[model samples]
Target: MLTNIFIIAITAEAMSGALAAGRRNMDLFGVALISFITALGGGTVRDMLLGNYPVTWTQHPLYIYLTIGAGLATILLARFIHRLNQIFLVLDSMGLIAFTIIGCNVALKLGYDTPVVIMSGMTTGIFGGILRDIMCNRTPQVLRHELYASVSLVVAVVYLTLMSLGVSHGVNTWGTFFFGLLLRLSAIRWKLSLPVFSYSPGRWGD
Candidate 1:
């Protein structure tokens, strides 16, 4: 079940990265590169932080192939895809939740504490998009607006709570996934965002 969800998450993220590359008028190589990074960057970072040697993609070469295939498919179906913005948004939200759950599980299995588990979830959910945005020279959505990382944090908390209460693994996983997805979709639908902080300079000698 986790494997299935992970595959979906990676594919969705890859497609999003491919679309970003396409929007920038990048070549196929650029599209593939961005897709690969966006799909695996978060997991890679998480593994590195945890010292889970070899990284995920290196351990599962098929993941790399899947991302590359997604990139190529996005390029081939660019026009049709562009017309389906809402669909992509839905997929992206699912991917975010899926990644968060996967990250939490990974940390839990590794005997990490709750705080680390929560941070791991957020890192897995958002860093891939961050890398993709940086590579594309666009402001990351997490930094600019939306309840992106917040949603992931919420998922981690819910998952942890459920586990502590002795909830079944299947229930915990799906419940967290659905709740997070709903929160993310609602945020998108209502343009929900965290309050922005702005810095202003005062008079030097005032």
Candidate 2:
């Protein structure tokens, strides 16, 4: 079940990356490159930080093929895909939640504490998009808009709470997944965002 969700999450991330590449008028190679990074960057970072060698895609080459294939498919269906913006947003939201859950689980299995688990979840959920945005020279949506990383933190907390209450793995997983997704989608629909931080240079000087 987790494997299936991970696959879906990576596929959605790849497509989103490809769409961003297209919007930037990138070539096929660029599209594939961004897609790979967007799909694997977070997991790669998590594994490296946890000292889990060999990394995920290195162990499972099929994930690489899947992300590249999704990117190519997005290129072929770019026009049709452009018409499904809302659907893609929902998919992206699901992907974010799925990544958060997977990351939290990985950290928990490694005997990490609550704060570390939440940080791991947030890293896995947002780092990929951050890398993609940097590569594309745009402000990351996670950093600028909506409650993206906050949603990931919420997923981690909810999962941990559920587990403490003796909830079954399946229920805990799906419950966190849907709750995070709904919260993220609601934020998107309602233009909700965290308060922005700013520094007034003149005031600081004064």
Candidate 3:
């Protein structure tokens, strides 16, 4: 079940990445590259950190083909996608929550400590989008946006707490998914955000 959702999440992310590439006036190759990164970069980073050889996408070549195909599909659908920003936001949030849970599970199985598990979840949730943004020459949204990474953190924390309380895997997964999705939707609807820190440039002697 989670694997199926993961596939859906990656497809959505691939399309989102394609949109970003198009906005940058990138070629077809660039679109495909960005789509691949946005779909799998986070999991790649997580696997590398955990020393898990053969990252997820490589082990499952279907993921690679699917993501690239999604990007190309996005290029064909670009004319209609701009109006579907809200839909994509929901899909992206789903991906964030799903990836975080999956990453946390991987770390837990490896006997990692709590902090590592949390960080694993977050890294898996956000790094793909961060990489895509970097490649597109833009600031990463998770670093400066409304409750993006926070949503991942919330999901991880909730899942961990549930696990420690001896919650069954099925309950924990569904519960955390709904909780995280609601939090993300609320953030978007209400424009919820952490306070930004901006600094004014000053003369050295001032």
Candidate 4:
């Protein structure tokens, strides 16, 4: 269930990013690169960190094909993709929630402790976007005041706690997904932000 949800979310994100690349008038190779990174970059980082051999894409060769197909599809569908900003935001939020849960679950299955799991989950959710943004010449959104990575962190801890308390796997899975999703949506809807530096000059320099 989670797997399928993540697959769809990844597809959406890849397609959205591909469309963005196309809108920027990038070439075919550039479009494909952006789509592939947006889709598989997070899972690739998670697997490498966990020392999972063969990586997710290599293990599931179909993922590569699907990513390419999705990219091409996005190129064809670009004309109708008028709401670029909204699509990117929605797909990114979904991708963050799905990848975070998957990361936490993978860590738990591998017998890692809670702190490790939480960090892994956060990284799994955000690093892909970091990479993509760098490639696309934009600041990474997770690094901003926007409660982005924080959402992944809080939900990961919630998932870990629930699992530790003997909650059913099914319950923990969906609960974390919605928790992360709500955190992101609330942040977006309310324009909520983490406290920023007040820029007291002497505080840092003196």
* Segments in model 3 whose C-alpha atoms lie over 4 Å from true places: 203-206
Candidate 3 lDDT over residue span 134-204, tens digit each: 99999998889889998899899999999999999999999999999999999999999999987666744
Candidate 1 per-residue lDDT, tens place, 13-119, comes to 89999998988999999999999999999999999998777787897889999998999899878878868889888888888888888888889889999999998
TM-score of each: 0.93, 0.92, 0.96, 0.88
For lDDT, the strongest prediction is: 3
Better of 2 and 4 by TM-score: 2
For model 1, state the Cα shift of residue 153 in Å: 0.8
Positional deviation of residue 101's Cα in model 1 after best superposition, in angstroms: 0.9
Q: Which 10 consecutive residues of model 4 have the lowest summed lDDT? A: 83-92
Off by over 4 Å in 2: 200-206
Model 2: per-residue Cα lDDT over 67-108, one tens digit each = 999998998888787688898888889888889888898888
Q: Which runs in model 1 stand beyond 4 Å of their true positions?
A: 200-206
Q: Using alpha carbons, what is the TM-score of model 2?
A: 0.92
